[model samples]
Target: MENLGVGKVLLVEDDERLAALIAHFLTQHGFEVRAVHRGDVALAAFLEFKPRVVVLDLMLPGQSGLHVCREIRAISDIPIVILTAKEDDLDHILGLESGADDYVIKPIKPPVLLARLRALQRRQVPQDSVRGALEFGRLVIDRSCREVRLGAQVIDLTTMEFELLWLLASAAGTLLSRDDILNRMRGIAFDGLNRSVDVYISKLRGKLNDNPREPVCIKTIWGKGYLFNPFAWEV
Candidate 1:
């Protein structure tokens, strides 16, 4: 097992036994783990603990996990991983749509969860290959600060949204297929049925104020891929 080094993690789980087990396992792997047993208090814990990553469960008391996820996303772009026993596609979609960066179907294997957490940590490090900031007319994406601004107004993007936008903007005007996006962002190949990429694209479009029906910023080249129009932000 590769030591992931010390990092703070917030675990939101209603099940006491599961939370304790997970917290213990992660602590053993050098993580400072804080466990919260209710969804309503999850945000408070998150604010106080300032965890680098959040492991959230859907079936939570006091509030739904999706609600907590959205609350956290509104204020921070910190990585969130949904750990739930629900295996349905709808549950997965809802989790991702609510701002989670990763989803793990549970009957928890500590090693697998640890691996996912490690991956999230790796993603936080700035990419040395990409430029520090990308400016397109009124839109600016600052990789150094992980900030995006449209004109004078700062845009609030979830972690996944920002990453997806950065990926597209970096390869402006080029068509990146769904398979390409899935592999690049999630480390998984598109199975023809997976819609995670589309979900994030929709989210990016909404935040960027691009009309989905006739988007100018992120254009859909049907049956092929997506293209980022670098010249469309002038308005």
Candidate 2:
């Protein structure tokens, strides 16, 4: 594979051999990769490198990958795909809760990892349908700038969160099932167990200032899916 020059990728892995191999593979597949072997310095490297995305390992020398993920997310919404060695459900949920955009369980398949990275990138790409800014009362969604503003305040959202919001808001009152959302956003069929959509929806609700207990804007349809009520955005 030749480098398509898609974007820069920051890889944080302790193992020298694995890091080198991952870097090489990503570089060949159109990414400029910078491999870092320490979690403590990952943030510094991220700030300096300003990569489009991050590939992080769970275990590190000093700082844990979860801590690194939280720190990175505090400043920027740069996409983070954590590499977790454990297949435990708690580990997976905790990684997402730590602000990681996605997680990959090792031993890693380079192609699968690459696909996940590309999916993250796709969320950042603007769509033709969202030509101009969308306004619902005080809420403003600007597709061109990929920004969402509530009243006078700017809401910070990860790439995935923003994409999910846009998809639902565009449909307004329509109910979007989990399978429907997965297919549209990820270009893949849902296996009925992928909770990425639900996780991101929670994150989006938090950022959007929607009440979790009595959510008015983005509401869950119980067994159906999710619904974005445009009218609920009003004061």
Candidate 3:
């Protein structure tokens, strides 16, 4: 983020007042915010702004927020928090199932929104950067070399694949959405499908002999996303 404490937010709400107020409050807290009223415009802003997160309203014009959410999930992994009207439970779960990392109801209080944003941010930073090595069974990730070793065999990986492995292994217990991986690692402008991530992750698992069913290391969070078992790193 260009700014420090406040993370960047791409706000997509038709209500001009709410968008401005939210942006102002978040900006005061050192967050970089960009407001877009239309879903299409919001998509454009998201790519250009490279926001760490996004605030989307389900009732957006030009394009429905649900559609936007699906489209965004197709490319980047930036965390997204959907804003929906009360009683819009269907849309809410759909948003999550569609790939949103979180959601907030309408009539949002600025303070609450800020708090939620912070909590999500806190979850992403690693708790043990100095650990040096991540060992999941016979598979080892040596941070110093930025390499993964399965027993005596070293598995070669692309830059993105290595990063994806690192991010998941480091998080351990946390669930990582595809959007979060793509956005943070590759930037929001990344143009690819979740399948790209799936393919890379699948390849890594195969090389490591990570069971696709009842995986011992990285596990798919079904309905939501993927999570790495830090306990899997216990040597």
Candidate 4:
């Protein structure tokens, strides 16, 4: 696999040896990696590093990675990949619920983690000089900065959430199949059982203030996937 000039990475892992190894491996793969061992200082390091993405360990001394993830999500839309020891569904669900873009369970393989990171990077929608932004009534999505504004309010979205929203909104009224979305966002084919796409969509709807019970902005079409109702955004 080719490296697409991947940007800065902030890695938060308590294991010194493992952190050093990951840092070395990622550095060799053309990523500027900053390793921090504590979860409490993770936000501070993140602010200082200004990393394009984050690799956070689930277990840390000062604070849990889930807490750190929530704190990070409160401020930025940067991609976050969580690292955990357990292979349980609780960990996976909690990681995603905590606002992580992806997760890697331990007994970690450098190449696999690298590939996952690369896949996340590929999801970023390039800023188009001509298009600039997308306007849908009261909602405005600025492609240049990946900022979403609903009238006077700024909607905070995680990197994955924004990517999914942008993809759906870009298509506007058209129905984008789950397979198509998964492939575009993660660079992986849908495996039928993976519900990450749905998870992201649910998060997106919540952030957009669309009622989960009957979402007007982003509608589910039963077997067909989702459709963005551009007209519903009008105040």
Candidate 5:
């Protein structure tokens, strides 16, 4: 396999041995990996290193990983891939809610981790064929800048959130099933259990100030899929 050349990665793992192993694996695959052991200093390292992606462990010495994830997200739209030992759905949901773009279970497989990282990197690159912003009344999604705005107010979105919104906006007036969403965004077919899409949609709706129960922008089609109402953003 060739090097992806995705660039710097900030790894926050308390286990020294595991961190070294993961860092080594990533380094071999053409990434500059910086491993931090404490959650409290993770933000500082992030600012200094300015990595393209963050691999965070939920359990840490100082602050928790979730806190770090939120802190980093507040300032940057950098993609975050959380590492958790627990296989529970709640933990995964928590990680995604904390602004992480993806989650990897511990007892980690380097290859799987690598694949996730690559997927995120791929999303960061704007599609050459699709250019400019998609404007809908007061709402505007600028793919070139990776920014979204409602009138004069700019909306803050995590990396994954932006990707999801862009996907839906690009296909305005279309009903995208969960399976279609997962496969297009994450390159994996939905198996009726992944709730990441729903979580992200809720977040986007909240940020866009769309009423959850009576959402006009992104509508839920009952048992079918989601639709981006091209006509609903006039307000």
Candidate 6:
């Protein structure tokens, strides 16, 4: 973990005591941390630190977590993981929708948080320098920037949307089973209810202008799963 190079981290928590503890824990784990209570100061510190990642608390004195998340996303694509006291599925999903790369419920142990942050930082690092962006006709996916473009149209996608689309595009024309997708998207033992993945798929299809009735890109493989038709880019 020491080789991770003490990446910069910004923590926005109103609880001063808890903030000190979290800051200490993160520093011990090789992360340079700046903990702030106000969103305004946090934003300023973020620019100064130019952190590789952020740990944002939903409850803030100056700005709501959602507001901060949106503002951060407007300027950059730095991966953000929102901390929330509520464990409701909808709340977590909303967090994802609001540009958060991940969500962690309260009562998280220090080790768990450290592990998740490290994982995120690892993913954020550039894995390929020479590999060209993925191009399927109008849909352009820049692997380096993590951005999507349809023809001349720039599109915004949630984290889950991006992940699902990336998986399908990477394996175009290959059928991926629903269970496999669920595990990959959520986890091997994800406990989400039945309609969660389905809902997300529906939403993604809408963004891609994919018609279920006369499907173009994503097609159902009957009882199997979904496949991204590589040939759709032509028609």
Best by TM-score: 5
Distance from true location, Cα of 141 in model 1, Å: 1.0
Which candidate do you rate higher for lDDT, 3 or 6? Answer: 6
Error of 6 at 226 (Å): 4.6
The true-versus-predicted C-alpha distance at residue 111 of model 4, in Å, is: 1.9
lDDT, candidate 1, 68-158, per-residue tens: 9999988887889998797777788898899998888889999889988887777777545445899999999998777899999999887
- TM-score of every candidate relative to the true structure: 0.88, 0.91, 0.57, 0.86, 0.93, 0.79
Stretches off by above 4 angstroms in model 6 are 1-6, 127-130, 144-147, 156-163, 177-188, 194-207, 211-216, 219-226
What's model 3's lDDT at 90? 57
Candidate 4 has what TM-score? 0.86
The positional error of residue 223 in candidate 1, measured at the CA in angstroms, is 2.4
Q: 10, model 3: CA deviation in Å? A: 0.8
2 against 3, candidate with superior TM-score: 2
Report clashes for each candidate as comma-separated counts: 0, 1, 6, 0, 0, 0
lDDT of 6 by residue, 44-140 (tens): 7777778878899888888888888888877766778888898777887676666777777787677778877876665555535525577888788
lDDT of 5 by residue, 1-235 (tens): 1122367999999999999999999999998999999999999999888888999999999999999999988888888999999988889899899899888888999999999999988877744545789999999999877779999999988878988998899899999999999988888888777788999999999999999999988999999989999988886
TM-score of 5: 0.93
Q: Lowest-scoring 10 consecutive residues by lDDT in candidate 1? A: 1-10
Per-residue alpha-carbon lDDT of candidate 3 for residues 1-235, written as tens digits (9 for 90 to 100):
1322337788999999999999999999988998999987877887788877888998888998988987876776556788888545555557765666666777898888887687666544442443478877677887666568877888765434566788888787888887887666544422333354666667667666679777867888776678887666445
Task: Report the candidate with higher lDDT, 5 versus 6.
Answer: 5
lDDT (Cα, tens digit) per residue for candidate 2, span 120-233:
877656445446778899899988778899999998877777778888988989999999998887777767667778888888888888898888889999999999999987
- Candidate 1's C-alpha runs over 4 A off are 1-6, 126-131
